[model samples]
Target: MTAPSAQTDRFVLDRMPPRDQWPAFRYDLPELRFPDQVNIASRLLDEAVENKGWADRPLLRSPQLTLTYAETRERVDRIAGYLINELKLEPGNRVLLRGGNSIGMALSWLAIVKAGLVAVATMPLLRAAELVQVIDKGQPAAAICDARLLSELELAREKRPGMVRHVVHFGSPDDPQDLGALAARQPPLFRACPTAADDIALLAFTSGTTGMPKAVVHTHRDVLAACECWPRHVLKAAPDDVVTGSPPLAFTFGLGGLLVFPMWAGASVYYPDAPYNPETMVRQMREHGVTTCYTAPTFYRQMAPHAKAIGIPTLRHCVSAGEALPDATRQLWKEATGIEMLDGIGATEMFHIFISSAGAEVKRGAIGKVVPGYQAKVVDDEGREVPRGTIGKLAVIGPTGCRYMEDQRQAKYVHEGWNHPGDAFLQDEEDYFHYQARDDDMIITAGYNVGGPEVEDCLLAHPAVAECGVVGKPDEERGMIIKAVVVLKAGQTGDPAMVKALQDHVKSHIAPYKYPREIEFVTVLPRTETGKLQRFRLRQHTP
Candidate 1:
């Protein structure tokens, strides 16, 4: 690793764990080798312009317009120049990005990276309280946000005055200080920062499903390495492929799938004008000729029916990874599109999917084999490797691993050079990993242990069920009882008979003990913005 330069901003670097505490970062693959001083934005964007074939290829496309690789690079350079010359942002200063999936948001992210600043991209739906948590932790010097989503950030700014010195908005004609206005005044040429490969590139905050969000720091090498692994081996997208997805750019999953992977493959990404629901996603894919997609299982389940009705002919690869991909959902998607959904497991800590399978390598119910650049194992609580087929915590080490920003929880997440991602898994004889549950999500009912996802999968197979969440409810008799909170399908009645039918369905499908002893029907189940079921919320509802 290269030593930090005097010009490099040390805010994030100063907060990172000492060298001895970091998980072992392996660069065994020849492609994973990075230069001492590297700027990922230059590799992903500027280098493409120098290539004959890739220079003119479309990089980012929306309903309104398309940006070629050269065009996108120019815009990135201008924005980066504006940040440095106009806003006086120093290298390593954090820049908060707030926006939905759009060309502007993508440009802002690349600019931040090019400027050698840490990008703290927040979800569009995040409120003032949530924004404050990130602001307090990252202490960003400036924010480049979508104008429409400025209210909450403004509120947060009011609460944390002096933390953020400058604010530039996009998608706002009324605002005189919009990013576009500032960029236009600057020259469209700026030298990429000469930062080290280990220099922090971005601060990816976790969804905070269980507690306050933790900022997962990723280095320039980490981001580049992630692109090399999954996109190179698993996804295998071509230059002509048009990619689209529902995950917001704020999420690492979205950032990789939508922007990074496409640029890495010399492929193009299509961002929709409006947010995509199931129907809209199908329509947009068909209209724009999208060949690759990345979204959650719930969205896939919803889109499967529409895909069957009006086929998405151009779509060849559909990647699912925010939560575990239920077998039922996978089968349904395959039946609908005649294409198997590529399932993978990744965390904010790891940057992108480290375990996944594409094409013929995909197993029926497994989250595929570990990617080429990574290693994983099922380990017991004591960090010893567990026997195959034994449920234990999943530990992983790769080119990109967890580095929390100034958080004590880092010790808990990284132990003895391995990242424990809090999920339990069992590896089979074939070396394929099967997700059981989050260590805390496993339910112990009447002395029988059950994975909540297994019960939810069984319930999802039933025609009457739309969505469901299972949790262990406190009980006086048994230590705990398996309780289910279900959302019925449209026009389906949620009565005693329906509940009994679901219970009976689960009993018939799997072990009888796994069936929910108590079932409560509701209009909807609580979920994160990324479509992960908030099982903790369901547990709170349970007695």
Candidate 2:
């Protein structure tokens, strides 16, 4: 149950899936309970300054500016005033956000939610073709975009002329129509909207690493509840910690790891001025005095070789998600920096990490026990619990779960009080959850089930292999054959002897029958902007 809504525009609220189809939520932790009327942006910023006494603590730090808690609240309030008083936007009007992980982008996102508007954030690399899909689905009333990335968004807006009525650009100091300039004109004190805890706060679209994208709906309570679970139990973040990461704010992994979790712990996030590469990321961590880091396994793999050379003395915690953390990558990073990587598995539907272990609790090959506030089990195809050590779909229920907006896939994601995250997993006697491959990505060769990650992990350990992706290619005789598309190291050549050496390398390490039957060498592997390997693209393009 929830308090009365304060939103005037019910476009998103009206389209929410029926209540009966929703996953059951739990509030075992004291912090998970919240008042019926609450706004996340206000609860995170204003309460921190006014009640928690973080007024003078540094909050948002970037190359351009560093703002204390009180100063950030003032900027957020002015932006809220511009959204409400100048733009004439009513509560619950969706505001589309398009930008990189910059100070301007963070302020815009906080202001949108503070004013009781639904924030729809898109990836910075998406072109007009992909942007149109989000615009048609979210049907936003206004947009706040980075001035540098405005061209593609403008092209998308031309296709759907009436979808978004207002637009403002940020990150442009000289433009009078920029968001910061307009925000400066408004009073620095604006009342926060009284949104219900259950009111929709953001619409997060899937990264489409697999296929079609789905819009995930999350509430104010969902955001705060997530902050209570993972960070409190596993992360144990301190107020003085400095956080830095490569995941973009558009991805939910970044949104929580980089922004929401840091704010919850009263930590500061330092955004680098330049886009991160392996060299740049390591150098930035050393220069910025970062204590906590977050990125995917792919980035960690690439950065492992450079970590010790550049030196990051202040770094203590390294969190990996967005994709599976292969044992090879974890070992590589540990050998380089001597810091045990914290591996967790989370989905956009679940909002953030539900299963993770930090410090000495981390297991060798399993994502640790469920966070204090969540429950997870591996279940067979028919929705019954499977025995330990048996691979099945991963079902989870927590403070947050899947709530898709007007998508038929909602039923497939949520059923019988549990949200199935579409991944295959197995539980051990110790209750550690071991990740298999995505249910659809599992390869069947000669009637034997082979997880692609197991083979890819073996290949990653080889000296000549820089990167690789494994998929099942259709075959007339054997049903499907395991195909490996590999990217060799700079000095390595893909000759006949080299292929035989790699094939022999896999046979010696893993099962001989599970080796890749077909191998193709290329300069680079196809990957999503978030550093996830695009297996679907490999299935399409691999010959």
Please give each candidate's TM-score: 0.98, 0.98
- Candidate 2: minimum summed lDDT over ten consecutive residues — where? 272-281
RMSD of 2: 1.1
Report the lDDT tens digits of candidate 1 across residue range 264-320.
Answer: 889999999765578988998999999999999999999999999999989999999
Q: Which digits, one per residue and each the tens of the lDDT, describe model 2 over residues 313-380? A: 99999999988888999999999999999999898999999999988999998878988999999998
RMSD of 1: 1.3
- Candidate 2's TM-score: 0.98
Error of 1 at 346 (Å): 0.3
Off by over 4 Å in 2: none
- List the pairs of residues colliding in candidate 2: none
Q: Which RMSD values do the candidates have, in order?
A: 1.3, 1.1
Which regions of candidate 1 are displaced past 4 Å?
A: 173-176
